[model samples]
Target: MSGISIVGVGNMARALAARALAGGNAVEIIGRDRVKAEELAGTLDGVTVGTAGAAPAGDIVILAAPYAGAAEVVREYGDALRGRIIVDITNPVAPDLQGLVVPDDSSGAQEIAGLAPEGAHVVKAFNTVFSHVLAAGPAEGRPLDVFVAGDDAQAKARVSAFVAGMGLRPWDIGGLAMARALENVALVELGLMNHSVKHTDFSLGITLLH
Candidate 1:
């Protein structure tokens, strides 16, 4: 992708912005707190902070905010996102960071799609990997895999290519409906383990293999 705009300034967003910078992608961060966005951007090269209402126009718009906050931000940026590809990196993890609290039939990514501008396409991505790993990865010069899913095939393609640009593998898991499974509580078990276990590196599991 030509450019990326991340809509948060938290750890995940920081890591993502860093990856985009390391990969040489032009990146802008739209933070709910403008000062925080500017502060974060100051620490990173090739990135600038943006106001909540004026997210930069980019080929990729990534929602790095918490799932609980995503819908509202989508609504806030509805007009600015027309004809854009939005990538959702939020997991609906409860405050306890132990489990997901989203509805059974829906996912944060899907919810974002509902709140997005009429023509904007939303894709699920990045939540499956931990932020620290994203920043410290590529031990073997090969970034870890990144999985993406969206209702629009072209949107998925756009996001998948962006993921690939970050030195990672990108796998398309079909339409946006798959995001529910992608962000399921069960999917985070390994990530939790990765944090609890010091030596073991954990990745999200896909059970399509026999």
Candidate 2:
């Protein structure tokens, strides 16, 4: 399994790091606050910690920050992320959860991709899963489906493999352009949570008639 570096110290970051470590992948947690990063690492056995500005030790770097801060995080890393697979897991939605905040033609992942250093491939994923559900593992005896969108086939494959390693399913929806739809998918999930679902334990999934 490929190693992963998660650049945040929040709930999503901790959930992902725990799953990656459970899958036997090398996991590194990075944050602007080294102490918080170290604290998160301490909770997970065998995980390493690094400061935000340092070059990540993993081949795949997950920008676990929110949509507002993701670009700045990437800019801070700069060329250090060159040739790495940058995973964007942000859903740029309005504060009231009424609509998306990004422009109609450009998604948050697209915006992040634009800021990524040359040679770095940006892949959109995990935006549809809630942090608590992810931390709790699969839902209703089924592995959660992680929707992936990226122009780079190899990068998507790597992410898919990592998802499978964590006992989940990865659905390669299409190129990065489809990231907009994925973001909307998250919005739909949130809408459901606020209305019908009334909870955060569920995740978006697909069922194929075989």
Candidate 3:
């Protein structure tokens, strides 16, 4: 398992960090507020904390913030993030929950990729999985299905490896262009949670018949 640096102190960050630690990877928490970062790190044994703007110490950097925050973090990191695998886990749904905020042709992950440095490979994943579901472990003993999309093959492979190591299924859904579909799936899941299903601890999964 590779070391992971999560640039947020929220639920998603903690959920990912817990999985990383479980996979024997060192986890680092970086946030705009050093105190919040430290507090979150303290809750997780063996986790390190760093302030925002510091060069990420991990090979994989997970932007666990909201869409806007994620963009700001990437822009603030700038060239220092070159050559790092940036995991874009944000869903760009409208605040009203009616639809997506991005244009029809582009997805949040693609937009974030545009903001990244030349060498920074952006991989879109984990947006469909709810934080509470991740925290509660696999649903009904079935591993979560994590859909990943990225233009960089090696970066996607790395993310897939990490997901597998953490006992989840990683489905490579092709280039970053596929992120639009992935983000739409996230929006659907959110709508279900907020309406039909009314649950926050459920995750989307695929079951194949034997």
Winner on TM-score (1 vs 2)? 2
How would the candidate models be sorted by lDDT, starting from the highest?
2, 3, 1
* Native-referenced Cα lDDT, model 2: 0.92
For each candidate, what TM-score against the reference?
0.87, 0.97, 0.97
Best by lDDT: 2
Q: Which residue segments of model 1 deviate by more than 4 Å?
A: 95-99, 140-143, 185-187, 190-201, 205-210
- 72-146 in candidate 2: lDDT tens per residue? 998888999999999999989999997888889989999999989899999999999989888898866787889
lDDT of 3 by residue, 1-210 (tens): 798999999999999999889989989999999999999999999999976898999999999999999999999999989999999999998988877888889999999999999999999999999887877777667888999999999999999999988888999999999999999999788889878999876778788898
Off by over 4 Å in 3: none
> What TM-score number comes out for model 3?
0.97
lDDT of 1 by residue, 1-210 (tens): 468889888988899998888777889988878899999999997687777877566768888887778778888877889988889887776666655677778887887888888888989988788788888766555458788889998888878877788887888988888887877643455555657664435555344456
